[model samples]
Target: MKRRFTVSVILSRCSLASSWIFYSEYFYNYQNEGRVEWVYGDGFAHNLNNVNNLVSSLRFVGDEDNWKMDSITLFEFDLFFGIEYYDWTDNTQVPSGMSTVGSLIITGQNYWTVYTSTNFSGNRACLQVQSGQYVGFAADLDEYGIFTVRSYRRGCFGDKKITLNSDQHGFAVKARE
Candidate 1:
């Protein structure tokens, strides 16, 4: 039997312009990170039904040219195999005048949700999944105070285990198969 796993991210209270830029930068950075590939919208949609080890990154890159600020929410989802893996990070800091409130990671049987707030101070939160649950972990923030979450599977392949970081800027989670 094949199992599907999905990961999603949602950002609340951000301007459309910023959202676009943020997402663009996110995809750019993800490609730079070299851990995953940039799968466009069509590629993502087409692969959702298959059980494979795939990583999809979606960002709400806000419009930087517009001086106007608009509250925005960003959400993304990924689906793969139960024993598959996916990971991401928002290394870039919000624009100077922008604020990030908070972030949340909700893990389910076949899907996970990550939510980020607009207020800068409030946007510093991380969620890690271990044994099919969100494991509160530590995070390490850069000079810009951008929060990130890193997760992977450990143990003997099928008997994998998860480890999570217990910090505000960075988080890690391990899961066992």
Candidate 2:
């Protein structure tokens, strides 16, 4: 039997017009820092499905524009909610001017609703039961600061992820065989 592994991320920094969210792709027990070819344009939010490439280290690149981290402490990610913060030990959170989007991870048997825009608006999806994965929309992603995850039941992925080939960014939930 096959199992579906999925993961998602946001910029986390508010004002960063562009940024890079890195993930360590893995398979079985082997993994690497970041080998995934990122377009890195306006950035991207992806829900990876079952595949050979699994993201392990989900990190937000804050210094792309060469902005010095003067005294602004990284934004504190909500302990239990949309923000995954995978293996982020050193410094967790971005400066005030920067805020990346976050994914609402679900587990067990609770319903989860995620909005492309905050307050639940513009292109939305939900997971009720079984194994369901929601891939965020690219167009709706421009809202910024609005896609904050609202979950009644969820948790962050420990060390596993699956992604799709995103060009226009579509959604598909595959069943294990």
Candidate 3:
């Protein structure tokens, strides 16, 4: 892990009301290490057993300085199927002892607030995705790197048909239209 993952977000237009960035890769840590920790990288929580801890969340509360009332969305993914890695830089990350994700989390907030488990009956892992991205299931976790998803959680966004996947079996929450 000699490479440094220096991530800095520069909003083309500083407006937080209707804009967001998807979580695909892990952001730099407080120590500014180039290593990847599984807190909230690749739109999924870091390795559940040992994840890249999430320090704080930044929300766009309809203003430039949203610290007053900014709300953060905390999403978690239980990796019971297997450990996976999501690389959005070029979508071609060859990890050592890691499997490729069939789907990716584009962007959104409050995703886990709707979905929780892979299926209603099973609790193999807890599911968490972005609110704005439409996600479905990944047929083969070891094959495709990214794929389009469909909604699985009920009562999400009130069937608003908003745009957003994986067994790699997990649940998803579709955002509002």
Candidate 4:
């Protein structure tokens, strides 16, 4: 028998000088037990007006000693399955077939330190980060028959002409008779 699922996207207003963007997709199989999976893409951008003015003014006054500022772009994708039982023993490990190019970190399992790297894929499975702890569970596996998927970004401050953008999107599923 097939099961029913629903998805939603909630967005907050962008800051006066900031912007946020995010998108995500989800999949699930209830007949096979309570199996759930999802993937998301997020982007962040900030304006650069102060830096530009500082450079131009220094050049005009012939005082171009040197000035510098840091700019960063962060991108991430997360894929995982949710189960009802706390024990993940029979969950199947499958790849999403999608990749990202940027600074990335993947962590799961309780009390385990974050693994920092340029790329991460397929090495870690059945592990989840919840309440700052890494927990593992199985797929098609349901004890309470409920699961959740989520993604988001936090905002920060900036100067004039400098705008920041933040956005997020994802999905979820629940078992019903």
Candidate 5:
């Protein structure tokens, strides 16, 4: 006999998060370059005309930054599902045989930048790392724009350290500014 699996079982194995983007068919041009036809979020995609696979460029228009601190994990499917690519170091391009990026997982105390095209060209989004303690699970790239990730660079803000010390009055204080 052979063991069988279900979609729910497979989903349960990996953690899930809320947030997604409506990918377009062209590069970022103030939404004028292409039409927004693919909506992916919360672990599923509303694919139309197979536009989800044709996303080429994206630009984050908002000022929001900061993401969960963890090792980078790129998913081939929305909502942090499918073909997971985990890495701690930066890369100029996606892994061999992997092309599209549906989601991201940023780790550690350093912010990372994910680009739409290779060599950090084309559209880009800077995922800032949360300050203080690291949260195990983080929100997926929420509305960061719609473009597949091709290359990524770590240490967006470099390594930040916070030191605690006791002052003369025995009161805990942050060491540096």
Candidate 6:
């Protein structure tokens, strides 16, 4: 019954970092046209000649001089489109066919908090990225009801900064140092 990818930390300067730091991998197909497939850390999506999903364009290599190492990609369908689960650390349960998370993407600098209940508790949403921009895409999160995300973690549990909604795709609620 060891269904983990699990994590449980609530502020107090929550901790959990180190997934083999290495920012900016590679994957291109369309406009970026031609061969270029290089991703370390994590697993899956090595289509090569077949080019599994034929990624049109991609680039989310965390650690732009260290943004908490950066990494977070979860999509089971929505604007981001089906099947994809990447991580950097922190999860109370999520990594087995990925329960449900429609769409979400964030890279570098830090910001993440998703819980529908698990070790992190219930009903919470905060995903940030937009200050010089590294990467931050929500695509669709059911208007913030969150489909089913058991638990998640990265940064921003609360201590100061706040920005719930706005342009360039908003989602912010940071604090914890």
Q: Each model's TM-score? A: 0.18, 0.24, 0.20, 0.15, 0.46, 0.26
- Per-residue error for 89 in candidate 2, Å, reads 24
Cα TM-score of candidate 6? 0.26
Name the runs in model 5 displaced over 4 angstroms.
1-70, 135-142, 157-177
Better of 2 and 6 by lDDT: 6
Off by over 4 Å in 2: 1-98, 102-104, 129-177
Instruction: Score candidate 5 by TM-score against the native.
Output: 0.46
Residue 87 alpha-carbon offset, candidate 6, angstroms: 11
Q: Which rank order by TM-score, best down to worst? A: 5, 6, 2, 3, 1, 4
RMSD of each: 18.7, 17.3, 15.6, 21.8, 16.2, 18.0
lDDT of 2 by residue, 23-130 (tens): 334321122112332222232344443221544443332232321111111212211112232211222222223344333222223333334343344444443323
Error of 4 at 21 (Å): 8.3
Ranking by lDDT: 6, 5, 2, 3, 1, 4
Evaluated with lDDT, which candidate comes out highest? 6
Global local distance difference test of model 3 = 0.25
Instruction: Report the Cα lDDT for residue 2, model 4.
Output: 27
**Over the stretch 1-177, how does candidate 4's per-residue lDDT look in tens digits?**
321111222232111111111112122121321322222121222232212111111100001121011112112221122111111122121123313211111222222111112122122222222343211212221221212211111121111111111112222333443
lDDT of 3 by residue, 1-177 (tens): 322222233431111222222221243221222222112222232122212233222221111232112122211222112233332121111333432223333222333212222222211122333343323232232233222121123223332232334111122222222
- Model 3, C-alpha of 7: deviation from truth (Å): 24
Off by over 4 Å in 3: 1-80, 99-133, 139-177
Task: Give the whole-model CA lDDT for all candidates, comma-separated.
Answer: 0.24, 0.27, 0.25, 0.20, 0.42, 0.49
Positional deviation of residue 18's Cα in model 5 after best superposition, in angstroms: 19
lDDT of 6 by residue, 65-146 (tens): 3433567777664444435677878888777677676766666656788777888887777677667554566656775557
Better of 4 and 6 by TM-score: 6
Which has the better lDDT: candidate 1, or candidate 6?
A: 6
Q: Model 1, 70-156: lDDT tens per residue?
A: 112221211111111112322223333223222222222122222233222233322233443222221222322434222211112
lDDT of 5 by residue, 78-171 (tens): 4433355777678899997666666555544556677778887766666653455232222234445646878888755223221211111110
- The runs of at least 3 residues in candidate 1 whose Cα sits more than 4 Å from the true structure, single-residue gaps closed, are 1-22, 26-28, 33-133, 136-163, 166-177
Q: Whose TM-score is higher: candidate 2's or candidate 4's? A: 2
At residue 167, candidate 5 shows an lDDT of 13
